[model samples]
Each structure stands twice: as structure tokens, then as C-alpha cells.
Target: MADDGLITIGALARACGLTASALRFYDDCGLLVPVRVDGATGYRYYSEAQVDRGVMIRRLRGIGVPLEAVAEIVDGDGARAERLLDAHVAELAERARAAAVVTRMIKEEIRAGAVLSAAALAAAIEQVRSAAALDREMPILAGVLVESSADSVTVTATDRYRLSTRAMVPVRPSGAAWSVVVDAGELGGIGSWLRGLDEVSVWSADDALILAGGGTERRCGVIDEAYPDYRAMLAGLAPVRTRVVVARDALLAALEDRGAAPIVFLADESGLLLSRDGSACIAATITGPRTELAFSPTTLRPALVSAIGPEIMLDIASADAPVVVRSATDGDLTTLVMPTAIMNSKENDA
Candidate 1:
């Protein structure tokens, strides 16, 4: 008995620094099973060799590995098990990086003694409302574009391939007019704090957009430059003959899980082709009569995903022209993306 390789469930649990119930729970979850069971007494016993495996299972589970995956690794080859752990490690690293960025931003805000203003809060909410599909890396350029009689505050951002545009209600301030740009991240952070407010006030001074209301004042820098003429870019496209209504969430889920690009919109009779350097040809379905234009996946997908409505309305010009995607409910926010081309011939010229 002293030399036996087996240990009682209680003893094993103590060795693993876990309770007996936890060990049983792990067995119930298929992560670990006792090596032998007493036929009549229904006693459970685990081999001493299983202690290390049990500890590892507990550690992996604590870190959020699914029970099924943990079982696969516990029973599979060492290399495959290591590969699984490595993938989890990489994911954790990404989460850590994102957390660090947020932590730093919070510390900065606290150090500056900044508070949110009514106008700034409203502008921030409007920014999210207008372009919810804008990429995080894309610069969120928001500011008041003031002219002689009217003042228009606009929020714009582009992932270089696709662009989004949103504008706030025009307000005529009784003073000289000028434009100021603000950082989108800072706006988003302050906006998060000032949720539930109906109106927010903002002022521009010392190259910063200041939000002052609710006894808190926060200052964020404004973006520089006149936002690109997105409106002009979207004008004069040929009418779209073919229109499709698709569920926004379904399409977005498919794209995120499978890396499937957005649906291609083509117009007129021109053929729109898709190909990668080492990938097979991608053919787009023809939903309506032929026309002359096409739109890029980069621009179309983000716009579609950002839409808050249940469905999206896709409209395209000819195969070579810009394609427009609009939220079924809000036509004011439109995304126009140019078509991409494939170069078939290989040539060398000095």
C-alpha cells in the first residue's frame, strides 16, 4: 500500500492545492478524470503522475482556456499542447497592450485636472452616432468648420481605403468664425464619462478643445487641416439600378470570422475582377442588370459594419466608378470607395 502509485481524491486535491470538490468538478467538465474507480464503494483514485497534469489544467482554466480545449491539450501531443498555449499567450499579450493604453489615457486625464464640457460631450456622442464603423487606427478628425453665416462641426476618419463623414447641427455663434480639430480618442474618452447628459458645451483655446460642464473641465487637442471634400467625391456618380438589402450583423459576423471581404457592388456592363498575388480568383455575384462601376472592399465593409440599423442599402455605379453604401435609415452618412484594379501583365521598364 505504501508503494502504490495511486492517491485518494482528497490527498490528490491537497497536493494540487485544490479542494476535492474542485477536482471532482474538473473531472465532471472532462478536463481530468480519475485513473480508476472502485466498483462497489464508488471511490475515486488518481495516479501520482496525474498531479502535474491536474495542476496544469487548473492553471489553463484560470486563464480562460475552454474546458474542451484544455482537455485536448491535456490528452494531445506535447507540440500541439505548446502551440495552443502559445496562441493563448499571444492573445493575452494583445489584451495587455490595449489595457495599458487605456490606463495611460486615464492617468493623463487625471493629471491634467480636465473635465468634460456640455458641447464637447454632445460632439463626442455625435461622433459615435455618425461613424460607429470607423477604424480605431484611422485618425478621428473632429472640429467645428465655421464659415460666415453658419458653423458646421464635422467628424471624419478614414482607414486610408474607406472614409466616414458625420456633421453636427449647425450653430451660429455671434463672433468671428474659425475651424478647430480635436483628437477622436480623447473625445471618445471624455464622452464615455459624460454619458446621460442632454447637451454639452465646448470652447477652443490654446490649440485645445475644452469641455466644461458638470463641474469638470477637460482639454483635448484639435486635429489640424481642412477635412477632405468628401461630399464632392460622392457626387455625380451614375444611378444605381441594382439594390440589395442585407442584415448588417450577419454580414459583419461573417466578415470577422471568415475574413470574407464585403459584398462587391458593380454597375453598368464593365466587369469588376478581384484577385490576390497568391490567391485564387474571387468572383462577385451579379445582383442586377449590368452597369459601369465598382467599389473597394476596404471602404464598403467598414461602412456596412458601422451601421447601427438592422440592414444596409448597397448602391453602386458602373464597374469602374465609386460605389456608395448608405445606412438604410440615415442617408446622410454615406461611404464612397473607389474600385481596385488587378495588374495581369508583368513588365520591366526603366
Candidate 2:
């Protein structure tokens, strides 16, 4: 120590296991002030008492604490500093989750085969998992139809009332086209298996369908029976003349509150009217001539739940055809609903 009872910046830095430049920068930033400065030599010095402060500063920075935050702690408000640290910890945790998901998104090309997005596979599984059979009439409807082509793997499912389809891209197509229907009931807990993976490969054997991703493999029984021509149904959809757009959440809220009667959509000059029985329950704007179509909200809510975006557009195809619901922001997700025999408010009273 100098005769003035002050230690030179060099000595202080050595004692604190830090560099003199770091101390100088900290001093300039007002985080740690020097005890003394030589006017002619322009050298900085610290008192022996500042050893603890210097050690704290070095250790805090070593742990990734920002300088501004260190200054707050040095100024005598440790509680506020703790709060800031807690916030940082929370941010790191969220990033970890997102990173895990992204890491699983990397497509690992199949050996002598193509690559597929495992995350997208997981999403497709989720969309169609609930489309299994309601009764025992058609056992084939209880499975999910998955087909892979040159660039995509498409998953489709339907329970007669609604059909859900999702396409995953980056799939290396096979020279020979192949399709299979896997029991969707086996899809339970599949999402958990793909939480941290980036890519997956799919294959099939005599009676089983397999999905391998994130170092995990899952297999389920396949339905040998021919799946209904879902593609034909979608392709043959009738043209539409009226379209009503409503935000998904808003439409869901109105439909969910439909007392006891089936949900009805009445579209005229006064806008679209959503009703439970004969009376109007929720009012929304419609973009075409007078048209009212009724169907069970209980039956229709599932499609709305599956639809994406700030608003869902309802495409009315004549009076007897199915209505298509799609995301307004992006047309990626679509839900098709078959209209009920009941299409007017006057039929409810009788």
C-alpha cells in the first residue's frame, strides 16, 4: 500500500483476481470509484477497505450480472438487485424450453431416404387424434390417414361431422407413393415424446406404423381396411357464395353460451346472428344476402377449437353443403362442418 494508505489500481486488481483495465472501466462507469488519483501521473488508486467491494464486483460480473445492475447493488439496494436477478432466471428458463423445441426442429435426413419435420409430425398427430370412431359402425374412421410425398406428410382424420387435415413439409418423397391409416387412439402421449426433438423418420411394417424422433420410437397398430376417400370429398367441395368472418375466441364464446338449443347462424343485412333456439343470442356482421344455417354448437365447437388465427372465416356453400372454417391470417388450417337439416329460426318454434 502507498504511504497515503491507498493501494494502486494494479494491486487492487491482483487482490480481486481481476484486470486493471476492468477496474478502470468500472471506475469510469461510476460502479467503483478510486480512492485517489495522481494529478500528474493520471494513475488511479484504491483504499485497502475497497478490497471487499472490488472482489464483489469481479465475482458478480463473472456470473453474468450486468454492470448497471451491479451499480444498483453497490448503491445499497440488494433487494431490488435480487428482483432483477430473479427476472433473468425466469427469462433463461423460457429460453431453455424454446431452445429444446427448436433443437428438435432440425431435419435429420433419413439414410438413403428423406427428412421430415418431427415437430410438424407431432402437430399433425394432435390435430387428428380426436377424430377416432364414435361408435362401432365404421372401424376405419378410428384411424389417422398419414401419407408422405416428395415434400410433405399429410395427416387426415374425420368422425363424419368434421374432418381435420394438416401437412408437414420438407419430407423427402418416395419413388413409390404409399399411404396408411394408424389407429389415432394410439396417439396419446405422443406430443410429450417430441418436446425436445428437431426431426423424425416414419416407417411401416406388416401391421404396425412407427414414428421415430428425438431418440424415441413409438409404434402403433395399423388398420388394413381402405380409408374413405377423404381427399375426394375435400376436392369435390361445392362452390360458396356467402362468407362470414368472426374472431375465433368471440365466436367460441357466443357458441359456448348457446343455452340448450342447437347453435344457429343467421346472416342478413343486420349481420350474422348466432342463436341457441329461435331468438338471437350473439350478433355478428355477415357479408352476403339473407342466409341462416343451424347446427349443433356442441358438434361445431370442436372445429372452431381446432381452427387457428385472430378470426375464423365461415364459407357457406348453398344451404345443404358443408361450411368451411379457415384461419383469416393464414389459410393453413381448415375445418369443414356439415350443415344440419334445420336451417331457419321459424323451424325452431314449430
Candidate 3:
């Protein structure tokens, strides 16, 4: 509307889909200052070239981005802007997860109690217990997740690097589904006590897990924390490129010999080879193409030792992808072991 082809503040506001007053506020904040200001009437005007910038600022603010973040995103280079946006998104996700946990804690109700074999439940708990994280910042990962339904009870735990889960058929299934996360240290002690009992009846109420059996009852406080979406990670795994079935004890012994060093696994039609500078070979029933992967002995040995059967099966998607480990004869327990790196990276560096 200005004579020199500069648009008035009102026109720029309409073009950018923002109110005149909003534009004035941004101008005052030095975010979208107008191109010109009339000395006589104190009127603000913007150049046509500034319209795109105004629109971008409006869009950035629309997403609830704080002005400081918005300034970083709008005024910084592409990579810096991307990093800022990603950080903002991660913060939002964390906040949302916390909110969801609080809401569930307030509104959730436990419908029925579950009856399960005490020995089997205890074993399941021990199998996955080692996967719980010890991070002070993430107290949620310090607990094990237990979910019960009409048919089965499943326990799962993860320390970000690996995850283990076991599903057991209940002696008497709950009439309704329920879930709770109990601290791993407390659960381990409870499991030890439960091992002596024949059966245990468990239920959740008021954010606590109560187990009753043999004329004795014990209660453990449930963690009011948000757990990571491990199911999504499991479901999103790529198709297995190689599969191998090998003796669990033999593999466990080989890993034990490796001590704390990293181990590389090389699998082919002939068999599977385990190596850490020195090498040991185990006969295996292998399918698919030859594949090689590496893992920390500490990270993988527990998974083999905790398996229920004599033989363990591994499903590998890639050298770097998470390897699925389960018992060949009894698949009730499953573990995902994340590879440290490909063999080439280790051998070449060494």
C-alpha cells in the first residue's frame, strides 16, 4: 500500500495469515521487523520479499515453539535448524509420555487376580531381570514390565542395549487384562521367595502388586513411570536374513571363555564360528546365506544361559541389526541382542 511498492502492515499480516497485532508483537520482538516505518504517522510497512519470512515465522510459532527456539530455527543454518527441531520434538515426546503415565495411574483399575505356577513365574522373572537398566535418570527402565491377560502372563525388561521377554500360560488366568512395572531389585527378592511356593496368586491395586500363597502375602510397590515402547521395536524388525540353531551350553562356554571381550559370530552352511582373536567352532543347523555379526560377550551370554532348552536359535537380519535369540525346543522366552558393530569394523581397526 506504500507508494514505493512497500506493503502496509495490514497487507503483510493478511498475506502471512497473522493478525496485525501479532505482527506488531513479532516486530517488537525483532523477529519480523517491517521494511519501512513512516516518520510522520509511525506506520509500519513490509517489502514483498519479507512476506515469505513472515509466513515462516507464523508457522513456526503455530507449533507452540518458544520464541528462543523459533529464533534459532528461523535464523540458523539448515543443519542447526534441523538439530533444534529434533531436540524440541524429543522434549515434547518425553513430556507426552510422562503425562500418559500419570493419566493411566489415576484412571487405571485392576479387574482380576491371576494364578500362576510360582516356580515358572520366578524363573521367567529371573530370565528377564538382568535386562533392566541401572540408570538413575531412567528409573522406569530399572523395573520389569508384567502384563496379564485371560490366557497368559508376559514379563519383559530392557536396558536399551538389549531386551528379553517371556510369556507363560497361567495356572488360572485373570478374567481381565492388567499390567504393572515392579522394581527389578524387589522383584528379584520376591522371585527367590516365590521359588519355594507351589503357586502364587497375584493382583495389582492402588499401584502395588500383591502376591498371596501358602497362607502368606507380600506386597510390592509398582513403579509409576513410563516404559519405552519395546513392542514397536520388536514389531518393526526387518526380515531375518540368516538363521542358526546351536547347542546352548557349548555357545555359553565359548562366550564365557571370551571373558569381557567382544565376540564375532560367523555363520554358514558348514557351522557357526565364535571368535575373539582366538576362535572356537560349533556345529549348527544353519539356513540362508553366510552371515557375520559381533556382540559383547557380556551382552549375549546371559541370553544363552537364561534359555530353557539345550539348543538356542538365532535369527539375524544383518551384521548390525538386532539378533533374535530364543530356545530351539522351547520358544517361550525370546531376547533381542543388539550387535556392537560389524566384524570388519573390529578386525580392521585391530
Provide the lDDT at 96 for model 3.
94
Cα lDDT of candidate 2 equals 0.75
Residue ranges of candidate 1 with Cα displaced over 4 Å: 1-152, 170-178, 236-241, 260-288, 291-299, 342-350
Q: Cα lDDT for residue 330, model 1?
A: 67
- State the lDDT at 135 in candidate 1: 47
The candidate 2 region of ten consecutive residues with least summed lDDT is 106-115
Off by over 4 Å in 2: 1-114, 171-176, 276-285, 343-350
Report lDDT (CA) for all predictions.
0.57, 0.75, 0.86
For all candidates, what are the clash counts?
27, 6, 0
Give per-residue CA lDDT, model 2, range 1-350, as digits (tens). Answer: 77888999989999999899998898889988997899999999898888899898887788677788778776767788788778767877888899877775533232223356767677767766665566657889888887767666678888888887876665655434457898877776777776567877776656876777666777888989999898788889987778887778877777666665766677766666764333544455577667767777656877888776678888887767888878777676667788777645476654
Q: Looking at model 3, report the run of 10 residues with the lowest lDDT sum.
A: 103-112
CA shift of 60, model 2, Å: 70
Best by TM-score: 3
Q: Please list the residue runs of candidate 3 whose C-alpha ends up more than 4 Å from where it truly belongs after superposition.
A: 1-111, 276-278, 343-350
TM of each candidate vs. truth: 0.45, 0.62, 0.66
For every candidate in turn, the CA RMSD to the true structure comes to 26.2, 20.0, 21.5
Ranking by lDDT: 3, 2, 1
